[model samples]
Target: MPFYHKLGKIPQKRHTQFKQPDGSLYHEELFSTIGFDSILSNAYHINPPAKIDSIEKVIVDASPVEWDAGLRPYHFKTKGLKFELDFITGRKPVLFNSDVIMSVCRPESQMDYFYRNATCDELIFVHEGEGMLESNFGFLDFRKGDYIVIPRSITFRLVHKTAPRLLVFESAGPIKTPKRYRNEFGQLLEHSPYCERDIRAPERLFTSSDKGDFIVKVKKENKIYSVHYDFHPFDVIGYDGFYFPWIFNIDDFMPITGKIHMPPPIHQTFEAPGFVVCSFVSRLLDYHPLAVPVPYSHSNVDSDEVLYYADGNFFSRKGIDYASISLHPGGLTHGPHPGTTEAALGKLETVETAVMMDTFKPLKLTNFARELNDENYYLSWKD
Candidate 1:
């Protein structure tokens, strides 16, 4: 996050003594990034954050994914994924590279233990169900169409009332709002697609002073390691910083309509070192009298484009329903289906809502990805 946010109570001055009722000092810890040179927050805890009671390393076979056909376009229908009881275990990695890993998770149960990603930022898109994301910073109430952006090393858990389907993107780089959207002072400019007001940060802080062993699963270097803490992980009495988790709903993003269809960059929501995330929300069609409403055919050239269809009718494709993922690899040419362009000409608007991820490097598909793949997708464009 670029802007400053604070929750709970803090001392008037940082690094100063803040005593509890028992005359003991509140433990202060700095959560920082990039060797303490980047965004950071100071959190005051009731107990030392380093007080660990036990440790266990969980071996996960997250081996590198491989493409079955060795680099070609693909269409995967992820609606067939089984419902898993554990949130983390439910995630099935579909496409991945050195920069990002894309997975789908359908959790039938709420998370029992807190979780932290030590090396990567997590962008979880809520496709179904509503939930509350609770963290040390505070609590964020999330609903369907919400994109929960959690920075690395933030201990958090999701509690949902209904079965949740999530599209999870784990990025090795920092996921931030588009740089061009903010000015030198980090304030969102007027022309940005979405403004700062649309960003939902932690609005309330709820601290727990429980004295019991709590397990936190920490993910680092493709492995999940567990540590037991003597005090509750959400014991933060106060915190103020630029780095924290936040939420942005797809429905809140104002689309940029045009006389002529605009490029995909116009829909960008977040940018990182190797990939960019864009939201395709329901918006009016192009107003140009002679415009081809559907996207024009073009070679991907330098990027691998992946689109996850979440809701509504997609104008440029045939037979794809909700939760369909289409991958157009670099060097391949792709566009609207056989008759979609002609059918889109007289349309005034499209109710489609989808998520797109464009990566600089090609992605590899996991073996599990083959289960829902449509082998005939390559021929769908033929008349």
Candidate 2:
């Protein structure tokens, strides 16, 4: 049986601290099939077991801090968040947190580990390549554009040797599939603009039992530790459910067509309480008597907007590069450059592609983020 909590409706003040049977810190209860809403509570689930078969022990309560800031951003919680490990590199599960940590990985790096705050659910976006995900329920395939929600503490691993790259969405609280898209019972309504059909789960099932010395890494209280496991964690034989490693391709994002192109609201792919992920793909420009394909300049007085330039020419902004992130926080006026807006005036179509995430709260910059910076981004708007 899978564990659940009515997170969407549950008041902020009320929360049940999930714990291990021993009442230690915590131990996730694995489930074979989870409904969309049931997952909002506790989504520690897998597909049916047939998709998975392996040998290893599951290590819970891991946190690997990729960075330690002398003064971290306000958006980051100084409190605590738990994480898990899944080695796509065929290593033991590992998780840890250090004031300073270095993870220089190649295209072959797997989960190794990640952190999830108590308040937010973790959203893993596959940016490139293909792979198989082994979970408690079963095995699931992950290809480009899939948004895998490992709601909280589901211990899993990636088994693809392909070029692996990821876009990770870390939320402070429960990340929910928009309720407006789902019916009262939490079922994705038939009329829902994007139904569950658009979500892709895993398909290939492969398991192994090579045992020498499996090292499990765990992070707690700003520290990282490693332990040895006798068996492989992918040992699951079968599972079935609504919760598992599913995929939602950016290409399948239903474009909200309109005579006059709409605002960023139309491209939204995933949402939590304070954040949203949107895909900006190839599409026809707006058709109107006086439509400007370029976004209008405006002031963001209350929130911070960070757009990670995913791919392609980001809508006419000259010299935009791949993977270059631009953040516009509150207290700034932003919009298309003077000529850029006018340049888009006569445009009839757009082949540009970009993946943007608008965070509701202001984001603090890590020293590393600052070091790998685009300082003159603001100056690009002028002639």
Candidate 3:
């Protein structure tokens, strides 16, 4: 395969030196920014001015999308779980044609995220399942949280192989870590503030046996090509680098607060470029004299906002299910369904739950997403 840069037994790479008491640089080739899923886009990217020297402003357009076809997808089925892929654009859904897309993987065991492909960095939200990911970097234990930038080129597998996991994959654009978290110099600031240690990089990369039929799918020219390797991709015994899986737990998020709370900032994590992720964890209502925990209604004149209901009550509207998402496009108004807003205020406290992701770029609704969707979402809140 052309995308297959088979490094043979030894991939061309130098080990990082934090260099050991005994001077030795091993061929630690495993953690090389797994970009196995790198892709060219049909959308336009624009960087707005960064007001805070640390924060960056990026604007994206649907132009990068191959609207003529839409997105592509990957599907898998393990034991306990079923993986379904719904793509917005990649290829015109003409069976087996795609690139730049999304995939949902449902696994049976507490599968070690224990493999890597120098492709497909993931902006993963654990829609279900709990536990940790053991990597060469460290151990990241999380349940139902949004994990962004599990880089493509690195090797990793989920640990505590028990329950199944619901994973979403966006294959077209790179799931970049935020750039503001690092200086132009690449060092995390005491204030840029999340550090490298905060991210769970693998402490030691493990090499796998190349004796099996490893059917790795490689995407090129928007088409997926299957390459059979004599061994598994996780053949590296030990490796290290800036490339690895780092986790930001939703609960660990240090939210910005004031006498009056501020709205969510787009630049929440990154510790990378072109990517910013935030976790909407379970939180107590604000202590303001008068705080409307429920969102107010207004047409978005600026950017498109998307919210994924990961877990919890989502502020009073009952009967909520997992993996529910709401997309309020620009030039449209949305608010607390209807009666919920007024009823919400009467209650002294709320145990609402949700995970929201707002994309500055407008996202078109996929036919599948539109189908599986709770069509009643928009009208459910009505009195």
Q: Which prediction has the highest TM-score against the true structure?
A: 1
Q: Residues 10-67, candidate 1: write the lDDT tens digits.
A: 9999999999889999999999899989999999999999888999755565544675
Superposed model 1: Cα runs more than 4 Å off = none
Question: Which lDDT value does model 2 have at 113?
Answer: 38
How many residue pairs in model 1 have overlapping backbones? 0
Tell me the TM-score of each prediction against the true structure: 0.97, 0.69, 0.64
Alpha-carbon lDDT, every model? 0.90, 0.50, 0.43
Local distance difference test, candidate 2: 0.50
**Candidate 2 Cα outliers beyond 4 Å, as residue runs:** 1-106, 109-120, 190-193, 204-213, 218-224
lDDT of 1 at 187: 87
> 237 in model 3: Cα distance from truth in Å?
4.3
Candidate 3's C-alpha runs over 4 A off are 1-104, 109-119, 130-148, 155-160, 171-177, 187-197, 209-212, 270-276, 316-319, 346-353
TM-score of 2: 0.69
Cα error of candidate 2 at position 222, Å: 5.9
Once model 3 is optimally superposed onto the true structure by TM-score, how far is the C-alpha of residue 315 displaced, in angstroms?
1.7
